[model samples]
Target chain A: MPAGDAFTPDQLYDIERAVRYAEETSGLHFSVYVGGADSETRPFAIELLNELDDPDRTVLVYVDPAGRRLEIVIGELAKRQLSDSSAGLAALTMQTSFATGDLTGGLVTGVQQLGTHAHQPPMLHANDEAHKL
Target chain B: MIVELSGHSLLVFVGIPVLVIAVLTLLVFASSIANGPRYRPGLSWWAPPVWINGPTATKPDPANLPELPELTASTQAPGATATATGVARTLGGASASW
Candidate 1:
């Protein structure tokens, strides 16, 4: 890893895998940002969220290690699938890990939980010709 | 009378034990050393920001992000900037601190 990089190659791989899992499970874009905020953490997080290709369908996880803050910003459409309460549950999980200085573990678990909460089960009968008729 | 210590006896008693302790210490710390620095609460962060699965288009610097305008009931559509578009109105999630 570079001197200025936050995670090692293996660690980054884990996070990216979790992100992929979340996207597949929830059918939504997932993004993660790890750094310090220029201003207040919440609005900065919102700003980061808006920077995505599909902001309305993206879930942005912003973690400020130096500030010891974590913000989970879900877009309008995504909010329907992932409730604020569910986001809170994930935040709580991340918070516990962060408090113990486990950034990678927290992010992996929290993103996974978010994806699971927003998971949409397949409709068994929807694909049937009889149902289409 | 007390026996005087010889050079070989000193090496066996002291040098071997010191070597064993040094090896043991290295073994205990090897993993963390390889892993590099870790994030600790309230400490100054060292690395640059990392964005995974972020926008394909290059984004403006966070430090230079335009000042957010006052939120209104009217929701603006997401444009290129999407900066002025108020997330407070539609954004929902959670906040936490350690």
Candidate 2:
């Protein structure tokens, strides 16, 4: 790890893997941002969410370590699948980890939880013909 | 009463113990040293902002973004609306602070 780097390569790998898993499971684009905010954290996070290619179906996790703030911004389409309550639960999980100075842990666990909560199970036979009598 | 401390005794009691303590201290701090600085709440952050799976991997200057139209009910459409800047009118999620 470099002197000012926020995460070691291994830690970054873990976080990326967790994000990938979340995206794969939930079928929603997942993004993570960690650092200081130039302005208010919420608006900063919203700006980040707007930067995504598919903002309507993306989830942006913004962490302002210096400000001790965490903002999980869900896109318009994503909100339907991942409700505010579920996001709140995930936020609680992250808050616990972050309070202990474990940024990576918080991100990984929170993302995983979000993915799980947002997961939509395949509806089998929905498109199939009726069964023979 | 004056007690004479032999060189051999000094090596066993002082030198060896100091060496052991030094090794233990290194072992305890080695992980943190390798990891560089860890994040502590309310402390100034050192690393540049990171955006994984964003529009660009590098952080963009907030000032560089074109000013967006102020969000207002009159500006909104019938149902869901996204501004020309792609800022969504409906946003859902939770906020927390440690």
Candidate 3:
């Protein structure tokens, strides 16, 4: 890892890959922020989510390892697709891995879970009504 | 008679053991030394910001969205009824049931 970077290249790569998978599976924006929060975690996470272009459709995962805090915030629209319970489940998975200091593994697994939970099957019937001969 | 040890004997007694110990230490720690330091909690982080789907990522930026209208405090009256449906329902009003 470079002097200013928090994660090694390999670690960053793994995290990025996990984010990609999460987005692909969920069709929602996924953003991860790992750092110390100046204030309360949940509010801070909400602030971060609001900074995005589309907070309503974005899911922000904030981890404060130093403070041992993990927050998963789903925006208004995102909450419709990913319920709070599902987010809590993902948080539990990440929390366990984080407690063990397996950040990469935890993130990969948690994000994968979120993606799976939010997965939507393609609608194949929209244009089929008029096509049946 | 006083006996003096030769330099070769001194080398075998001290130098070889030191060399063996050095090699053993290197063997024990070679992986860690190569991989560098591991992260410990509460320590200062050293990495830069990495945005996986950020502007730097290859994915195209989402099209610009229409700007939202600003809501000022004056626009919303105080003590208005807030509904659980996330809609504002009229409060302090009498209604006839159908």
lDDT of 3 at A69: 79
Q: Please provide, for model 1 over B1-98, each residue's C-alpha lDDT reduced to its tens digit, 9 standing for 90 to 100.
A: 99888999999998999999999999999998898777777778879999999889886665676567765445554321245543343678999999
Best to worst by lDDT, what's the order? Answer: 1, 2, 3
**What is the C-alpha RMSD, rounded to one decimal, of candidate 3?**
10.1
Q: Choose the strongest candidate by lDDT.
A: 1
**Top candidate when judged by DockQ against the true structure:** 1
Arrange candidates, best DockQ first.
1, 2, 3
Error of 2 at B98 (Å): 0.8
lDDT of 3 by residue, A26-94 (tens): 898888887767798766666666556665687788777666677877766776678777887888888
- Residue B11 C-alpha lDDT in model 3: 99
Which residue runs does candidate 2 get wrong by more than 4 Å?
A: A1-3, A131-133, B1-10, B56-72, B75-88
Q: Which candidate, 2 or 3, would have the higher DockQ against the true structure? A: 2
Question: DockQ, in order, for the candidates?
Answer: 0.54, 0.50, 0.14
Relative to the unseen true structure, what is the C-alpha lDDT of residue B84 in candidate 2, on a scale of 0 to 100? Answer: 52
Error of 2 at A40 (Å): 1.1
Candidate 1 docking category? medium
